[model samples]
Target: MENYNVDTVLKDIFDSKDSNNWKPSDKIPLVTKEIETLKNDLKTFLKSSDYNMDAILKESQELCDETNLLVSGMEMCKQEIEEETMAEILHSIENHDRLTKELESVNFALNIVYDVVQCGKYVKEFDDGREAQSFTRAVEAVYDLLQYIEMPAEGFKQLDMYNNTRHTAQLILDSLLSDLYGEWDRLISTSVKPGNKKTTITITLNIEDSLIVIDVLNALEKSKKLVEKVMEFSQFLLKDVLVPIINNDCIVFAETDELMTITVNQKPDFKPAYDAVIANLRLLFHYLSNKLNVEYYRDNSIMKMMGKQICAEFSDILVKDCLIDTIPNNINELQSYGQITSEIEDFQHFLVIVKFFPDDKISILKYVNNIDILFASKSSQYFLETARTIMLKDLSVTMSIGVETIPEGNPGTSADVSGTEEEALKILNKTMPRSLFYFPRCMISKTAQELLDLVYVMMEQAVQCSDVVCKKLYNTTRLVFELYDAVVPYHHENYLQTIPQYVALFHNNCMYLAHNLQTFGDKWLILMEGRELDYPISFVDLVQKLRDLGYRHLAIHMQQQRKQILDNIRSSDLNCIVVKDVLSDNAEAAVRQCLRQLHLLKNVWIGVFPINVFTRLMATLVNMFVDELIHRVCTVEDISMEMATQLTDMYTLVVQKAPLLFQNTTDVEQYVKSWKKLQELIFVLGGSLKDIEKHWKDGTGPLAVHFNTEELRSLIKALFQNTQFRANLLSKIK
Candidate 1:
């Protein structure tokens, strides 16, 4: 309960005691009768209304108590004034109490007004239509009340309930939409006349109009509740304007659920239209944000319009998605892969351009397909599948049967009667493409392998070189490069298409070229080296950046070339084992086997290995062959002229095969050492061993020409005991 100053009220009212109405003696009864009337009036007035009756009832009860205080002393006090006049004065106090309750109602009115303003200020848009209209009506009600009783600050000061309420300067901004929109549309000028005739136009906003919006913005910012209200309302207006553009006219198909003709063939030409849209939006939203000071509203509203209204809706409807599905399936068709890849690149490029909004810090690209991830992972996998399919179908690659071996101790199994797999023969077979005739025609296949190459390059950045998926993608790319290179000859000879026998001739020529490359060696290797491409990308260009990574040389088929002579020689080594080398029964066989194997191994390496290594293998084989023949002859029991002739013949045959080995005098001398040693051995047996030994020691005898005294004595003493050697010695001596 509030403390009431009834004494002050009575003192002020009684200050008129000296007025020319009545004596001081008569005033007492007048006050007594008036207080009794005031008490009766309170009981009557309290029954009028129930709203805010707590304060009204409290005031009435307090006034009744005050009446008792003022006139209760009537019997003890004297009367001075008229009873009727004092009763009128007390009745007037009842009216003042009622007026205070009405003032509380006025404060409640201001609270309602501030609330409607807050509704417009708080959010970007009234997403709920019913709520938006309810707030609008509430603001109008406040505006109407503002006409009669301007909200006095004094009414709100006493009330704790209405203390924090803010009456915005933009009191009825919700009411200003029609006129502001008119100004916007007028500035935009809906039907722009390019020439004499007015054209039907869709895009209404322009940079020039942003200036008009600028002035309007300056005025609106002065009333931020109005700016916030406009920021929210502008969205509905923007959607009404922009969403229709996407639904009606779009570069790509955006499904707006409209009954219109949209087909794959009718794909939108988006660049020019998007250029205009972006330019207009950039300027329009920026000016709105600056003028109204609601950047969040401007950016959010436009992003929603672009993404939900335009990009996302259109992406779902694009006919290109169907093409993306088939690209993996049609990897073998070069033209189809090329076309599909070209189209996808264009699509992604367009999205990149569209998503770029200079005015917006956050991209409005949420609705996109995220083609980066798609191309990196899925598209790459699809391309690999395509390449593998091509390799399987066109190249004729398949699993091959390996050599099967039984345990070392197993019997020959010739006695086995049953046909169980344990007794079954381990078979040997080869698997090869039917048309490995494909080799000589080095370049008969072409592929759209560059797409896979691009994918490899892109993914390599995201992964390591050793990563399995990356390695597989790289191999696929490399094979595609191989296929492209294989048929690259036709690329340079486009006019050959008119020639009737061009394909046949070209294939025959490739075969001829490959055969020459295999047989002739370094001339072809040198010619083919660094000839893959003249620029950055070649069929053999290092995709993995590792050496020897891509297409095997067309001459790889040459690995299968005939080696019948060398094979027979190798087979010969398994059949022969010589005793004392050339003197043994199988010495010639061993010598021939060893020399032929060495020749085959050396000649084979000439095409692949460095020249020094080939020379070394040749030298080793020659030296070993000569040494073996000489050693057996020197140790033979019947050392004679015939043995010397045979040993010399073998050395000459070897020199003939490889003339470079004996090109120098010293090398030729080294070559003859075995022949010379045989001759001196036969001479020592023909002559006296004692004299040969003495001459050998002095370096002056027939044996001394080749051997020292110790070697001569050793040879002569060994041969002297064998009867067959002594007989050949006697015959040679005769």
Candidate 2:
């Protein structure tokens, strides 16, 4: 009935504002009356015939289309704002690209300038002592290049050229410095005078500077593989060139004294070049020592060379003296001691002569004096003795040095037996010296008596030799006596069988010497006196005496003889008799006598011998007699306690008191017996004591029934009756 258009109504309301301002109360009454009238009219219109609804729906659809159009316009405005932002980003990217290219160009130009400055400094160092004009030109060229590098550039392409140019300039400067150094070395080495060479060269190189010194040292260290090359150059210069030039007589300069005087007149000039060369060599050695971990000294090798050079110089001086007739020919005619022979005998003979002659009377007194001086100053008696021996022997044969002979009927005889036709005999007399006679008398004098006693002991202990020659030199009876005395007392029977040959030879030598010297009259007497021989007899007579005495068959039937003597003693009715009377006058002689008797007894008694006798035989021989019997007992599977104890004690005694004397098999067996005896005694005694403790109170008459008198008697009888016990007891006899 009253379809209102809001925009038309709002426009009507705004347009009527000026009119409504005319009267608000009048407008309100008129509007209210018109609304009531419009309401009545709408109700009347609705109640009337149907109005057109299709036309109204068409107008509503047109209003919805207008709202959709307005929303589309707002979306289009947002898209236009985003497109403007994208345009601004594109413009910023182009600006960044332009700034990047400019920065790269600036960096490149700066790098070029830096490199050019470094290269120019190096070039200036290289050309430091060159012509000013040339140096100035080179410096200006470098400056111009630097300027060019500093010129403004647009991009990296232009700047890259500046960097390349700068690097090329550095390369050129390095090459120029290297060439200049080479030329400078060559010029200094060649152009300087010999006397001024060191100073000029040192100033030119300035190798003393820290940087320069380090470089040189580093180069030397790196050149280790070139050692052989350096050595070869040194050898060529010193040996091939310098040595020969210095040695040349034709190239002699002013006399040394004159040159030294003139040089002294002038102020001393410092040798910088010489010092540089020395420093260079020192650096080289230092590098080698560090690399190799060795001790290096410059003076050591140089001094060795200098020594050889000095020797050569001295030889040259002598040669020059000879050429100039500065020394007389007679000066060379002084007595020449001949070359020394290395033979020991030659040396020994020389010592004998030196010992016999008076020191002051020596013909070549200077050589003798040198020896005395050496002995006094150096305390090299051994070496001096050796040298003196050599010299004396050489002079003796070569110079025909005479040896004085003992006067006829003189009591004293010369020890030197040189030039005598009589063959020297090794007399087995206790009085003769055991050591080499030429041993310095002064040194031996302090111990002479002891040495003499040892010699006596050796002589007395010498077993006779089987040789005829030896028997003639040494008395056979004396040798046999010595063999008997040296043999273990009770075991003499065992050793007697083995020693006849040595005895026989000793006798043969003694006899031969006696027979040969008989015709020499007092000279033979003197020789005998020197040998200290007790009695002189022929070798044949001595052999005959030995044969008559049964010594010829002693070795063959010694065991049989010893057994016979044992049987005789065991069966003898005489009880408690002195063993000495039963055997011989002397103790040692009695032993030999008893041994022979026992060997005979063994053969006679054979199987009739008691077990105790056999055991005693073994023990006796085992204790004092070591031969097959002792060996058999030692190796036997079951050794009795008694035998073991005896062996232990014997061993202990021998080891402590006289070890050297017990070196023989028989003696060693005795010593072992002593040791075994001591050990067994300790064990048995300890066991017995332990048993006694178990059975007895602290103090008691008898510990137990087993320790009673009757029981002890029985045990004692059993022990004494034991084969080992009997043997051990019997062993102590002969």
Candidate 3:
């Protein structure tokens, strides 16, 4: 520049360093003028032209070198900064991981504390006493420790404690509810007094184990203040769970009492420990029912209870009435009677009272006056009548009326003979009306005639005997007649109307007679027959004769009747044939009636037959022809000697043809004796059959020759030898 100073040159180079890529150096300005001049020259040169070419060149070279150095330095600095930034990021990441691990540890500890608290609460609800207390204490300690540790992290500490406590409390409350419900159910299931009616309780828990666990976990997770939260949950449950259970149980108990007075008189001493148990059980059931919303009333327990109550009541009543005891006694007595009895005299007396006061008028009146007195007075009547009705029917009674003459202390007016007679008539008339009335004529009207005839014959026979036996017979006959007087007149008034009643009375009398016979032996029959001295012989003869004659006559009559009816149907006019057909159509019924009557007579005879005779003649007759005899005879009057002969012959032939039929060695001797007797019967029946056959063959008999001829021949052959003929005769007879 004008003799450029080295210092200036250096200064210029240094100052320009800022403008170019040159390193700037710290230097002081020399003088004000020089600094001004240098600044002006620098401005002029910068504005006008490129200055300091050689110097600029040298400076540029140096600047280029410096630029290179500066760029290298900047790149190094950038590299260092990038390395530092990466290191800081890595450090922050490490710190975050450490904090995360610590938080996780805290959460894990809180969870453990919450679980312990929940377990404790559950134990408390279970009310396991010492076990529950220990568990609760352990839980509380765990919760306290967890709270202390979590205190520093304000948000986490509060939230964790609350969640743990709340969760534990909820578990305790739920357990309490379940326990209360269970207790209620047990109480209701127990039986109580007043008929010992049992009550049933049902409960349903809807919450599953998994669901309970899940809810408990959720509550614990959300809870913050452990202790307060636990207590709050417990209080909530006590109010929501226990109170409802208790209230519901009480209501159910109260309602049951109002609905039915468990009349436990039958189970007088029955008492259960808990009266409220049933109610509680019912409450539990109600709760379950409501929660489930289903019908469960017909539960097995309920049905069982109902059934037990019904059975117990039935047993008590059945025992108290002594019905079971009376049934066997009545049946045994009936069997002994050997005949059905309708009119038991004692029973008749009871029936008379019952019928007249069927509405219990008299009895009720008496009861109203004094129940105990009525029951005591009439207890016998009730039991006896009940038993008699069970054994008989159509009962009636007659009470003897007596008049007592009384002397008046003084006559108020004239002599009162007419008044006294009228009064007596009124009393008799009023006391005995349609139900309890007695008219002498009406009483003796029907049965009196038959009874009197029998009595007359009996009296005559008794008189003829004229011995001690005869005297006994006479006394018995007199007594029978006296009994007739007592019963006949009252019974005969409505003979057809009261036939059933009469039959019952007859049965009772037969029973009485049978009892007497059993006590006194065949003396009664002998007395009736009037052969007091030779009673045994006479009785046997009479019985045998009756059997023979009765059987024979009945068989013949039946055969004749059947043939007559068939003949009528075949040979009669159309109208007559129609009528006969109608009659024949009902023949089965008629036959059955005949058979029943015969069976009755047979039963009576068999019952009274001597054991010896039964083993001999009667047994044989019964075996061979009892069925035929029953079918043919409607009454004892139909029996005849001819029938007995036929039966005897038939039995003899059968025994001869098939000896095995008489296999019983004990009875074989009897059969032989019976067979001998049958030989005589054969002769008698053969004669009758021959006579009937001859009459029909001569065409002098209404019996068709073809019919009677075949029947007679068959009967003879069957009695004699042929199986075909016997079978044919059996068919006809049967």
Q: What tens digits encode model 2's per-residue C-alpha lDDT throughout 1-734?
A: 34766467545544664774666675676567767877898778766748666777998899899989989998998798788977898999999999999998888777656665654564464355234323324434444454454553444335565567667656644554454445334321211123322211111122222433333333232323124333443344344323333232112122221120001111243222222322332332232222222112232222233223333442233233221121111112112222211222232233223232122332212223343232222222222333233222211111111112323332223456553422334332234443212111111111112222332332232212112322232343233323322331223343334443222222222222233223323333333443434455333433344333333343344455446444443343111122212312232233344445434444432222222323344344334432322222223333344443443343344334322222232443344344343333333223343343333333342333223333332323322444664444333222
User: What lDDT score is found at residue 516 in candidate 3?
Assistant: 28
lDDT of 3 at 194: 21
Candidate 3 per-residue lDDT over residues 71-130, each given as its tens digit: 999999999979798899899999999999999989877876765565455445434432
lDDT of 1 by residue, 91-158 (tens): 89999999999998887877766644544444223223225534343334334434323453444445
Off by over 4 Å in 2: 1-83, 105-734
lDDT of each: 0.40, 0.35, 0.38
Q: Which has the greatest TM-score?
A: 1
Worst 10 residues of 3 by lDDT: 436-445
TM-score of 1: 0.25
RMSD of 2: 31.7
Better of 2 and 3 by lDDT: 3
Model 3 lDDT on a 0 to 1 scale: 0.38
Q: Is candidate 1 or candidate 2 better by TM-score?
A: 1
Which of 1 and 3 is ahead in TM-score? 1
User: TM-score of each candidate?
Assistant: 0.25, 0.20, 0.19
